[model samples]
Target: MIDGALAPLRILHLEDSDLDAELIEAELENLEHPVVIERVMTRDAFAAAAVADRYDLILADYVLPTFDGVSALGIARAQCPDIPFVFCSGTLGEDLAVEALKNGATDYITKQRLDRMTRTVVRALAEARARADKRAAEAALQALNQTLEARIAERTRELAEANAALQAQIVERERAEEALRLAQRLEAVGQLTSGVAHDFNNLLTVIAGNIEFLERAVLDERSKRRLAMMRGAAARGASLTAQLLAFSRRQRLDPSPVSLNTTVASMRDLLQSSIGGAVRIETMLQPDLWPARVDATQIELVILNLAINARDAMAVGGRLIIETANVAVAAPPTRPERPSPGEYVMISVSDTGTGMPPEVLARVFEPFFTTKEVGKGSGLGLAQVYGFVKQSGGGIRIDTVPGEGTSIKVYLPRDETEADGDDVKPEPVDCAVRHPPGSTPVLLVVDDDAEVREVTATRLVETGYDVREAGSGLQALAFLEADPCIDLIVIDFAMPGMNGAEAATEIRRRWPALPVLFVTGFADTGALAQAGVVGADGIVQKPFRDGELERKVARMLSARQAPGLRLVADRGRRS
Candidate 1:
């Protein structure tokens, strides 16, 4: 590309039909940039031109009498991987196009959609240029570093102390840069995993909701058994998705002030049984340890995962020490993911086992990245621990030496707002819905996903509430403005246009006394907190157990103290 005018591009076209080749050339010529297409009709010609790397792009037909586009793509990738490869064929199907993309084709198009070729070609070339720019920038960085080191070495005789100080600074900067790179990579992976998990959660909600309805209608012993199995399978799927979300730091967590010393002490017998007779487990508890506000169950799981990982590393018997203490971090350690300087409750898990090398350490926090043999690990062990700690306002650091041992330290922010009864958790009391003892509470369910909205609305309806449906936040608002008899709202967090939080803000402005219960598959907690939605009274995660939503809704509505919220009770409930 040129600033004033588009530069001419050299394109290699592989098509058996002369007419099709001419059409391809015509579409490409229509581009703002000039194009010089070298057309090839035979296997020999195509292979020779592809390996030459003399073209900016390659366009090929999927099928040919003696040659194929896939083979041409392979040759191009092997010889000149930088060149963008696209397939334009009359016989190309959707599945084949997907396969071609998976096999490294830049883009795929059918003859019927040839108009898309020009746009695709333009975008592909731009992306290739971007990739080239990134490579050049990285190369420049390396060159600069090399030049600095060489100059420092040359000046060592005259400036020995200065050289030594500069060398340490250089080493520290390099470590920080490496850590930043790793953090960026893991963050990108977390984003993709969270999106996929959100979709899976929505699907699971539908399946589980329908199954709950079916379980009520069918009571045959054999049928009941099959349904139970299916429900269990659904639960397993939800658990897998939850683990993925946990790795992404997007899973809903219930945090409380808990003592890690007590947690570890309780898990002692379980840890012994889990690790078997191979690894010797020990715990060192700090007497006056400050309580950390974290999800107790998740922390337990994190400890167990660390224990199991240690056990796996030590094929033969080894020592696994779990220690906890209060520490004031002066500064964050040189790690990609680190905690801020603050008071923290630190837990160290040290193992005398086969330690990880640099390559394994780099990807230790990535979801589903494991060095163990296939069937032995799901690779989510460290990822879950990493995400949980990070999400709980904490940091984790790993110290390992090959052939020596490994130690992982987790730093959780000390809970400063602990009250007297914070340690005592209340047992669940069955919430029997009784709104003013004589009226049904009207609830509005808002969601962008139709099936999810239906499932949620149905559940609320079955649970003895009068439920209304809205496909979006705007619609929900409209319903509320028209119907003041509505007592509470159950809204999805993620939506197009105005989201649930935005609507909730507007709803609060108009109806301050009406409470909201958020129903969500996945939520970006930071964003919600910024929007002031995280502190809202109620939230029920998606794929929730049978009674979870009901309990939350019942409690919220009951707290409103009447059949309808606020002024609505004064106006009387609608029939």
Candidate 2:
């Protein structure tokens, strides 16, 4: 309510009798704070004046000539909704006045109660203003609540969108991590295969050379026949070793954008020779097929391996079909394994052979899991195919039934660029034919393996080197301390007490100008740098060729005289 000290009450008096209006005006004038009263006799006059200016209170007579007090109260309510309306009637009874108060009238005054008129008007006006202020406060509070709800809803939507994006990023990261782990596992298998292949190649070289020497020495027919069998077995072992290296992905790869049509056309003769004259080979290559990114030689190997498997499946003659086509994976496949979606060039090999059951098909790509007889297959063919396709960022699928034929599909990623024009062919090098000269220098062979040391020393001596052998780092150090003129030190990396790297360190510390060569079967060699052998004179992988050993020794000895510090020469040799 507005304090009476700040604002005076504005009263509208509606009555037909001029005397009654004057009486109410005089009653209000007697108050300490003056009230402003505007008198209107007709309803038309009341409404016109109320539209121009509103009142804080309404005083109406019960009976007017043209209208009644009830009609005047309505006019006041329409113009100023919260104003107090009171009735002052000469003929209105106590019951009728009570009825008016129930119908929105604040209070009523009879003609007999002239003294109570002023106090009733003041109290009625104060109460009406209090109700008005409360309604205003409630409206403002409701508006503020609506605004807060809107803000919270908007923030909730933003959080939902952010959560969805975070989930997508997590999925992509997990996929990349899985692919990296698979690659590392393949690399570990490759390391093991490389070690095995190196040792097998060296053994084959010895056995084959010795067999040829015995053939020249032996004259009996039975001895020659047994020697021929041994040579044949050694050759087969060498072939199996090569396949293992290929399946483990250890063989060197030279990748290029290759046309499937051209590669298949060139391999017609070789495939015929390998598969024999029984199976009929057919090719259905798309003329405008997209090129694939892969090593051509490895792809050839994959084709041959698949053809051989097809031949084995069909003991009798059967038709083999090789088809090439372009494919696009627009969405993830509906398999449990979610393969990536992209463009690919698919090469499918289908054969009308004795098909495999589900059991055989499931284990076809596992290494050494073969269906052939014990001595007939090495079981690395399909494993090599799997490794090749996976390494090229692609996938493979196989379909087979018990009685129906079998089909294997290899998907290779498509390259957008055209094949290069040069496309120079690579020349094959025969390592056995290129033997080093038999004039070996003074040599020091160091190995923790007693057998390896003895064999290497014997071979070097036969090639005309004054050979010395050491079975440990301490033994090599002792030998070096006694004879400083030893030409080269071939040290093994894995020794029992002092390793080859430590032995090389001690040798260099004593004789700064000494030449040291490391021979290791292990893949990682960075440890040599940390052991103070910062620059090695040379590094030959273990089970090396006679040519490799001889060439490395000659190169290191010749580099020592090239007018620089021996350490500098070592650095140049390593580079």
Candidate 3:
């Protein structure tokens, strides 16, 4: 999608000559910037244009037979105070030019020196953008402050009410109850964020898919730049949503057995470069470290996050020590509040920096809770680490002293299964998609969202497949029964009735060999596993980039065959 912020610059030109307007358009167009210009000559026309349309810059002649640039500038200032207005005239005195500048004209350019037009227009527009950005930042900060204040006020009121219930029990029960409520509230927020992320991911998918087509269609440098900007923004949004999913513990994880020592040693250069020359990094790896079941990429991220946090805490030079060890957890009174009993692999990050205070420590793992000033940190770093550790069926502990330093220990469940290799990945199926011998591949798209369903089906159709849409799993089954031509099913995991997983389970019971591709947002892995969606091959995360959906579908279809032969390999009955 072309966000207004990144769209072509809209220009309002007040020029009497059609030829001059054309020249200006040609000049601006040749500057390699996307632009749209609307020419208005008469005073009334200028007035109407100023009021009717929003523009980034206004270009006007210094003097016309009937009206003047100053008058038009005044009108523009009154109508669009923030827009940049400049004068391009054939004749104007130095005094008049100074007067024009005093009267709010961004700049004046003589018609003879049209070469300066690009510089003037670019500068004016750049200033306008800077002002708009500053205002936006201020407004966002105000909104964030207001929100934080409101939440604090509400929490205080709730605590006050609890205090009133029993004066003596207030202290003890309040702490306990507050902890309970905090846990419940965080859980609830995680669920809500997960659902919202899902819907948002669906929208992003449609937007990104269309953008891909646009990227291919537009060949000009200017248009490509605009598309590039939009694509970059979309990628950033995807990254942020991924962080939210990680913090919410809904991120789809791919786990395998790997040595933590190897993961840590691999980051030697990255840690040094990221932490800078000021901080010294040391590693203490045990001779025998157990392999733990984990996502190697995520473990790398967790370590990076902790290192960055430690770097931030230490304004001056400090030492960072990363260590790995094997530990057996006992189910005794020792640290009974946590961790349970199990064999685990531990990765510890210790920093000789200013440690967090009690207040900051209390909410350190909470999402969006940060001690650093705004913009320095997202607060999701620790939250993501916490969620990833917990979701991996592991534990995390923080030891800190206010004036001393901090140590964060992450425990990953020890894997009994021997590794085929470090962080071994499943061998992929045949990835060459071919059409059925006698028929074009027919695909079924099941999604509760009409827009998402349409987008998915359209992409498949454009890819040269016969596509069918269903708003529900029941409807999908009905379609499957009506047409025996569906070679693949691309269905959303979260739906109103009979979700993708459930539907896939039912489909499997009826026909076990059919390829089912699960589309989802920050999804519940427990549900998918219970419903029997196979490994990463069967699932695609939401807000997928341009050709991601296509690639996933192609891979799934590559594993399929002609309808009759496919059926023969599975159950005999076809619904």
Candidate 4:
């Protein structure tokens, strides 16, 4: 029902009699909502009017001059399917009206009982509105379903991406943990190797010194030749020990500000000749490269070792390219092993040769982890390079593809100072000093090793000094306290109970004017200085040549006699 007073209801009437249409309109006028009606008599007018205009209901006559009520109902059903259709006729029989109801008409009323017209119209309009509401509800539900499905799909994609990023982060964390473990293992091994080399160097020095004495005493050609062979074998042993020291980062270094380009350029001829005609050598030195503070000779050794490894890989010949550049690391590098953000001097060596596989590359920096045949390689080459670079406060990166090639990059921290020309050159000196004879300088030699103590005493005696020996720092201290005649003290840096530095500290307190020299295999000068033992003359490595020992001892003694002269030690000649 339209409440009888709302907006007008639009109605279309298909009736032949104008009076009959007015009667039907009057019947609807009593109902809710004002009625607006259009009368079309012929079937053509009814069809044309329904198509052109929208309406709320359709009232038609069962019988007409041009068309019947059934024809009008059919046209209204086709043109405006949702509008209510009703037949009103004076001669509409009950059976015909029932038949019309079954054919899509809402209701049919006889003119004799036209009072029911308003009730039928009200019921038809209500049903029409209910149908429209149902359709609208179904359409809104369909739209909601589509929106929910699209949102679900987008959320699923975002979750998948987050999962993938988490997986990548897990992998990187695992790799970093593994690298840390490898570093710890290498450090422990280096410490052990250094300890063994320290003792081995002392033994080798004894053997070499005795061999020299035998060579001078034996005059026969066969014996002299045999002694020379023994000396050569000892020298080779010394070289091997040196390699161990290098890999363990226990070898002495003379660090200075040096240009990477200049160092690489100077080694060009030597590298080419050593690698031979089979391999081609090239350089791409950056003109404005920054200087780095490092041991120039050791850096050259690192390059040479890498080049030699490259040459060996290229059995059929290949090209070796060395490049230097100044790099600014503003963020973490693409390679994880490189240093953190700062300026650096980068040296890259690339070779067009057989590259290493993943497994070999992983273990390449490990000492004695070689891929070569039984005796072809000692396997310390890359290890030495790794130690040298790390000890010089640098990082190394290696990139290789199985069949492509290999490129190794070394990044050393930048030194703003200019490069020194004599960075790699050893200090020139006359080590053969004539021993001055007056009162023989009473010297005290302290070492935990009995053989080292005996050998050192023998060398001092041969060099025109009265020598005394002690097996430990405690023994040396006891000896010095008992006899105040000792002119100088030669103590091993590392001892069992009390170290050389501690003994030196005690000696300095008791005898402030006494000069002391420290001997060790460790190359950590900063550590030694912290222990109150400083100066190159005051520190000497084990297995030193007789001339080196003599020169150092002579210099210290000369300084003692002339209190005015300052005692200075240059590591260049000490090595």
Question: Which candidate has the top score in TM-score?
Answer: 4
Ranking of candidates on TM-score, top first? 4, 1, 2, 3
Write the residue-wise lDDT of candidate 2 on 323-382 in tens digits: 777888787643212235988888888888889986786567666789899989877788
TM-score of decoy 4:
0.57
The regions of model 4 sitting more than 4 angstroms off are: 2-27, 35-128, 154-162, 329-338, 416-575
Clashing pairs in 1: none
Clashing pairs in 4: 4-32, 4-33
Task: Supply the TM-score for candidate 2.
Answer: 0.44
- Candidate lDDT scores, in order, read 0.80, 0.72, 0.78, 0.77
Candidate 4, 343-419: lDDT as tens digits: 78899889988899988987788788898889889888988887877777777889898777899998887874433
Reference-based lDDT, residue 144, model 3: 96
What's the number of clashes in each of the models?
Answer: 0, 0, 0, 2
Tell me which residue pairs clash in candidate 3. none
By lDDT, the candidates rank as 1, 3, 4, 2
All predictions: root-mean-square deviation over Cα? 35.0, 23.3, 35.2, 22.8
Residues 22-85 of candidate 1 have per-residue lDDT tens digits of: 7877777667677788889888898788765588889999999998888888888888999999
Q: List residue ranges in candidate 1 displaced over 4 A.
A: 1-158, 216-226, 417-575
Winning candidate number (lDDT) = 1
